[model samples]
Target chain A: MKAALRNPVDFSQFPDANGHFDRYGGRFVAETLMEALHELNEAWRDCRNDPEFLAELDADLAHYVGRPSPLYYAERWSRQLGGARIYLKREDLNHTGAHKINNTVGQALLAKRMGKTRLIAETGAGQHGVASATVAARLGMECVVYMGAEDIQRQALNVYRMRLLGATVQPVTSGSRTLKDALNEALRDWVANVDNTFYMIGTVAGPHPYPLMVREFQAVIGREAREQMLSEYNVLPDALVACVGGGSNAIGLFHPFLNDSEVAIYGVEAAGSGIDTGRHAATLCAGQPGVLHGNRTYLLNDEHGQITETHSVSAGLDYPGVGPEHAWLKDIGRAQYVAITDDEALQGFHDLTRAEGIIPALESSHALAYVTKLAPTMRPDQSIVVNLSGRGDKDIYTVAALEGIQL
Target chain B: MNRITHRFQELRRAGRKVLIPYITAGDPHPELTVPMLHALVAAGADIIELGVPFSDPMADGPVIQKACERALAQGMTPRRVLELVREFRQIDAQTPLVLMGYLNPIERMGHAAFVAAARDAGVDGVLTVDLPPEEAAEPIELMSAAGIAPIFLVAPTSSVERIRRTAQLAQGYLYYVSLKGVTGSAALNVAEVAEKLATIRACTDLPLGVGFGIKDPPTAAAVARIADAVVVGSALVAKMHELADDPERMRREVAAQLAAMRQAMDQAGMPTAFAG
Candidate 1:
């Protein structure tokens, strides 16, 4: 038997012909909306390579969403951990208070460029809903956000925020009444309104163009962090860390650093309870490779091959499956994946709020927990950069309620 | 026995209700799969449905998807699952084995190649969950050439026209999904199922296998009273997940469950055990 030769392009050229990222990402959508996705793919391909489009996006990121969010050197926390000097990329400082706004702004602009008049989005924790609504408000485009009924109750403030921004929030009461259900409802909605509605997905999970497109939009975090670190520290940070739910934040922090052989990337998944307890959201750490929600990726499931309910303190990170690109990254050994329990994240959340006076989102606290672990073992000269993906205002009340502490 | 047909005929003649337990290969760990299969057979499973894990299993609820994830994580593949069947044939040649999965993986492996491989692997039947009977011609013909029964699913939502179409190509027995939603969902409404079974029975004399939401011995027994086979998947798969690390314990628990169901079915008025 003859061996087939392998392709030589890097991860950027991936999802080749068949929509596979090393047999991971592919179109697993219904037949009805394949044409819309294909059209989106064609538009994205043309727009991504256009200098004018790139320039416009760059300007939007810089002036609109406030890109190049500062790299704050955490000296006190660094000294307390005793591992290495730690720098935080303040994506949480962005206009919408999270990295989600970056992708939503870019996507909304692209939708306008493609002549889309209306926008639809599916949200789990409602961060993306708020971000999408912000973009729609800015662009004067009609917006509808589909969120699971369960999520609407848990994140009522975000739902209110979306409505305040002129976007209609539709609560989906199907299936588990969570992210997956909202996604299914959104897909159905897209199929029904495929002609004019631009479905703006929240993360890098879904089918082909989504994982690639969202990653590209979020990649700005890593690109800016790398340049900033090089200019300030005169070297690439020893390790780059971020939380992985649907993996958009982690992929954003890791994508630009992928070509840097010397830089190590770490993705911290939420271990709601613990991996052994079978109640965690550590898809890459504890899950198996499978297909769900349009992409082949690591998923937490059971013996009959069914997807199980995932647990995490952060509503944003509570999912059973992860982006296929994360699977490809794990396969290629470009990224190291780890998990932090809810307790650890909560502790980190408290530590950051007290020490830095920065309330970090519960999802971003997972990365902070990793930093707490990584800092203790690093050399004094080595620096670690953590992508602080979002602010913690939305999570403070929930965390305080869990701890039985009043603000 | 002439394999599936003969097994069904023998079951009918003996007035026995068949017990089918589903298990995803390579779950918990890939290496224990063959042993688990042998154990399932020993545990009172009349026929085994080996599920091939696919990424997008839309028909499955959470339990089955989790099982697929575990199996796929252990690097389970169609070829590997077939090898498990072949290895099981070494000790138990009479037990019928069915490969249940979606069509994409088989299509990826090429239909012709898959049929040949499945046959070589000692597979007797194939059930593609998402493929309708109208589009099942190519794969069904290929499997028929290999003497493998191609099982089809009939739902409560299935019109008489759809049932007639599915029955035309369906061999072995008709698999009637008792619920409107995915597998492992709510319990089967026996009355509704009985009506649907009657509708299906009106069309063909081929044995009817009732599955989806038939969880416990009582449900299985109730289903046995009206159907040829009671296919219990989620319940069995749940046991596998619970006993993933201990194959011996899994075998004992699963076998005991099946035996209890078998006994329940026997008491429910089957003429004999293992009847079609």
Candidate 2:
């Protein structure tokens, strides 16, 4: 029985003309990038509804990026939880092994239409860098990825993979020498080369258009899941869950279901040591409202306006800020955010691999770990959909190191 | 007229380019900041940009990053930076001082509170690196009510329409980033900077002070040729980093660097007045 009786929530009302959602998300970039952002906003507004542009985007998404990834019902894993049925949205099955390509492909096409000859991005775990590099290669455009020197050392395989894909992996060695530093460096590069280069931001973070734009691109996950759920199960799931690093994957899975009043959504943040210990990247759960990386969202900072260092077993989930829309959602109580420790995520990594023969990315494992707790509490007839954001091949080294065994 | 406009006007009447030197408050040590301000004035700095030490300075290079780190470690807060300004105002009320940094510190303190505190501390202007014009309404209004000139940055990549918007929104002189990169970057292309300044000048009568690559005396002189003011930051901040263990040498060396640039700018001020 699909009990659906509620007032509909309008989707178009949010992120007003200035790109703000009530109080969150705005064009908070340097002045040099204002015109470029305005141009991008105009181009996106024009292309979003244009039939020809939509045709091109849809064609690329289907033929090139492999859209409408399967929604697999994890029967064995669902039985193990013993409370609710579980379905995994297989974003890992997409080309480049993650949901990140969905956005990189969309933005690269926009970049092409805008006459941009090069694509540049910043990546922490190298997932986005690879995705951006893959799209740039497909578009016959030059690509450069700014990665922190530390991340390059940590994610050596991904660095090699990016280089093999014909992208220049520039190492940034400033500040804490991680994703934030790489992001700063990438912004510098974009400002310097705004004439020829397009900054294909990997997440639903950054300034105004990016948070809105990336969510629109990645919303394919939720849109497909919505149709698949109705066609296969005859009902929308009781809940949707995904990990929230910069909240790209989570936002993608949650956006389409936003107006569906009964479908609950949850965002799991990485609690490295613990939220109480202040070492985690759970910005929404533990942070205050402040500005960083172009938007005023939740931030992990000290008494002064300095960004604080964050820790996580998964490099992809270690950023200090979450997406601005997520902040708005959290504040308005549309979504609930919880933190899962590194050990808990690691347990999730082993459990899914052993039970369902799925090697989920450490980032996706965070989402799985949350569902592990949440699913067991729900009724047996109820079900939940968790976005399996990526594969775990990138985490072999970090997982091995956790057990004191070098990979 | 505001202190910033009046100072620029005074410099214009004297046929000399304005020299603005920047130092992170509480960098090296908090106690030395007041003396550093006085020394900068003595070294011919027409205006001073007191960096409100922030933890994450994205637009800055290594030099300002370390300076912010040291200042933060020493427990420098926005209020402390304001206190330092109050102290500087005690000795010298003539030279204008601008508070500069990312917006988090100010946002942490309410915008109205920060503006009021700045006004009370005799801060004539402010330059928030990350506060773009589109998102600057409330802060601009607060600053305007407090008679604090809200400074804005105009990068080389800024379009003419963008500059016009900045000109309408901005209260003080525009801070022109000479190059596309962060502070302490390589030397800028003079012709390119001159071309951008011309586009900017067409938008407003506001004075433009160029920084972010003017590291040495010649570069300062070169930028001073095409702009009304020459602003230097990372070069002097780098000196403070090198002399962290020795406060006397830090002050002396930083002052010497500013003095050289000031002398160079003053010498090159009249010949090339915003012209090719």
lDDT of 2 by residue, B147-177 (tens): 9999999987787877898899887799998
Please, what are the lDDT tens digits per residue for candidate 2 over residues A170-274?
998877788888898888888778888899999999987999999999999999999999999899999999999999999999999988878999999999999
Model 2 chain B scores worst on lDDT over the 10 consecutive residues at B267-276
Off by over 4 Å in 2: A1-9, B270-276
lDDT of 1 by residue, A130-163 (tens): 9999999998999999898988888878989999
> DockQ of candidates 1 onward, in order?
0.04, 0.62
For model 1, the stretches where C-alpha displacement exceeds 4 angstroms are: A1-9, B1-276
Q: What's the lDDT for residue B8 in model 2?
A: 90
Q: What share of the true interface contacts does each candidate keep?
A: 0.00, 0.65
* lDDT of model 1 at position A105: 86
Candidate 1 RMSD to the real structure: 11.5
Listed for every candidate in order, the interface RMSD values in angstroms are 8.2, 1.7
